[model samples]
Target chain A: MYALIKAEIFKLFRQGKTYYAIGALFSIEAIILLSAYFQGTNIIDLLLENLKQRFYFEGTLLNGNLLVYLILNTLWFHLPLILMIVVSGMLTAEYKDRTLQTIMLQPVSKWKFILSKYIVAIVFTLLVVLALALSSFGLSYFFFGKGDLVVYLNGLNFFDASDAYYRLRWSFVSGALSMVFFSVASLTIAILFKEAAKTWIVSAFFLILSNILLKVDFGDNWFNALFFAKLNDTWQYFFYYQINWEQIHFNSLLSIGYSLLFMGAGIYWFHRKDIG
Target chain B: MLFSQVLLGNVFAQPVDPDLLKLKSRLDSIQSFTTQLTLSVDISFINMPVKKAQMMYTKGQKVKFSSGDFVMLPKRGLDFSLNSLLEYDFITVDRGMEMQDGKNCKVINIIPTDKRADFSIATVWMDTRLRRLVASEINTKKDGSYTVHFQYNQDQKVLPDKVTVNFEIEKIRIPINFMGKDTDIDRKKMRAAGSKTGAIYLTMSNYQIKTLL
Candidate 1:
């Protein structure tokens, strides 16, 4: 498994395509950074004026919380697209290029090949997410300086030292896992489509559909159970400070359940599927 | 005891002829006084349970009232004092019914020209019955449909002494059990603690009223 994982990572990083994706990520981050540097200060001042009326967000003007907010705002929408691109290419690109036929000619199990692809996709997604997260933290620290990290949750603002750390740490972990599930879904869709164009369309379709489905409330518990409706809101449970822990744990388990079911079904389908 | 002194006290207390003249004269003598006062806002739309903030103002009519971050001009051409009902153009003579507090009470309806003005109409129950201006009820408009009652402290009317402004509005009900973190344990003890979220008492205590030359 380790050798297969390592080889998959090597194939991914060695490719010119991965570098192009990284370049795109850098360019996007730079544009956002410059935009925030110029406009974020004024927006932060306005937010402070409004917040002072309701919550006590005590600190110097440019605080850590403000920086964290800017990063989260920028990456929330963009990161998913990046994940789709990276994951779709991992398995489907080989199939598109007819390289999968050559790779299968070698002595390797179909299950191992699929597992390697999944693991590689997971690693790439994590790498990009963590890099962006860390870079955001660094840039925000550079510009705003460190102060108490305040977050607004449940009609209340949290500023306590311990709570902020707990929320950030848990959110990061849960967020990474959610993205992995998303990558698995993308990989599955990509494999189904032999052509690259179809792969992009399918991945994009699910991304949009997931977002739309999240908004529509299905009152029926039975139907709601079947759909991964609003997984982002489920992720928010970890980030929000005042959440009832027992209930939050239940939702977290539900999210993991969705992710696992998708991955399990994708693997089963791919194993049964003939390359012809 | 002198007849005049006894008569004067009765007149002031009952606000009959002599007492009425005295109260009006006292109000007229002070052309203008500048005072720093705190105004607390309690509105239903505020969303929060309690909203308390302090505002300092220099009031005059033409009333140039400036608080820390806001400046508003009250309509009726501005030389108005909430202290004197007549000064605010809220006074009228009801000859049929005698004024209760005594000098000679009037039944007058005051319409504020300022559209943004907080209260819709102030129907003053005035009396020249005392040393200063007497009793009054300032009914304010709420949400264009509901009326909020603000009853003033009639007995205590002077600068520096706090006047209690009583009010009652629609009751705000929120769930008792908090879903989030356990910041406060005592919150668990209560079944559901309900209070008037819309009612706020503005107590104006100290006034730095200054007269301009």
Candidate 2:
């Protein structure tokens, strides 16, 4: 497993496209940090100001919570695109570039070959998310000056930078795992359709479909909690400074379940499928 | 400062009248009263210009303020109301005395009970002679502070025609264009954002008081 994973990592690094994903995430975060520092005024400030007229704000904007928010906003809609760009080509490249035949001739089992690729993809996805979180923090801190964390959630306020950091770290962990599941799902779709165009379409189709499914409110709290639509909500529940874990534990568990299910299916389909 | 310019100090010269205490006690005993108040919100925290909103306030289980065609329900999200601005809860406590506008006045501090309630504190200056609120210093928890000078009418049922809101603001320098309803609008959002610079002065010319229980 270790050797195969190492080989997969080497192959990924050899390809120049992986670095582009990192570059894009940094570029986007830099632009947003610049905008936040220079925009002078915006909706969030207005909302907070309106509240301040009546209450006191406890923390500073330079903390991890705001950085987390910035990452989520920057990557929210564009994540699937990032996954498609960097991940869709993983196995498909070997197949398209006629390297799969060479790999098949090796003494290693096919399952190891596929599992190595999957492990590499997951690790790559984690690294990409960590890069995003770090970039957001670095850029915002560069411009805004590092201070204590401040977050406004569900109309309540909380302070203390240390606690905020843990919340942010856990949120990043959960969010990064969720993104891996999404990337794996995309990779699975990429494998199913050999043609790059068909792979892109299938990947995008499922991404949009999952997003749409979550938005459907059935007026049933239990049902909504069960659906993956509450992914963002689940992140908030887990990472919020003062979270009522008991109330939203079920939803957080559901998010974990969905992520694992998607990843498992991706590996299952990828290992069993035959190439032309 | 009930009658700051009045010729005689008779308002206070008659000695602290026992009746005056009764009147004050009467007003105080009415822990919360439902009344219609007309106000102007003066935003003075921007350099492009000073902005103001004229609103009518109604108090009951909730406090509603209506300005122009917009009503803001402050207690519940960023809701827009064309008819009234509602505050789900407001709490007032007597914060002792203060001298303002060159006269001695009792100060009452008002705070919103809702966690998301916006106004941080409102300090009202009441004139002992007039038995009415004379001036108010409204401090937003997040931004600048504004002072409203009130000139009450004799009827005690409505406010005077001329109301002034004084603002203290800080200047902010930015490098990009912000998109709003108007492309060329820079100060609108800062005014909305309460960017801690500039002052607003409000003057009301006409008086119309409609009484509703």
Best prediction by TM-score: 1
Poorly placed runs, candidate 2 (over 4 Å):
A52-68, A147-153, A156-160, A221-223, A238-241, A246-253, B1-213
Candidate 1 CAPRI category: incorrect
Query: Relative to the unseen true structure, what is the C-alpha lDDT of residue B80 in candidate 1, on a scale of 0 to 100?
Result: 27
True contacts kept of each: 0.00, 0.01
True contacts kept of 2: 0.01
Candidate 1 lDDT, A7-72, residue by residue in tens: 889889887888887788777767766776777656545534433322222234344444555455
User: Model 1 chain B, poorest ten-residue lDDT window?
Assistant: B69-78
lDDT of 1 by residue, B116-200 (tens): 5555565543443335433444544542222222233555443323322333333222233222222222333222432233332
Error of 1 at B56 (Å): 15
Alpha-carbon lDDT of model 1:
0.53
Tell me the lDDT of model 1 at B86. 34
Interface RMSD of each: 11.9, 15.4
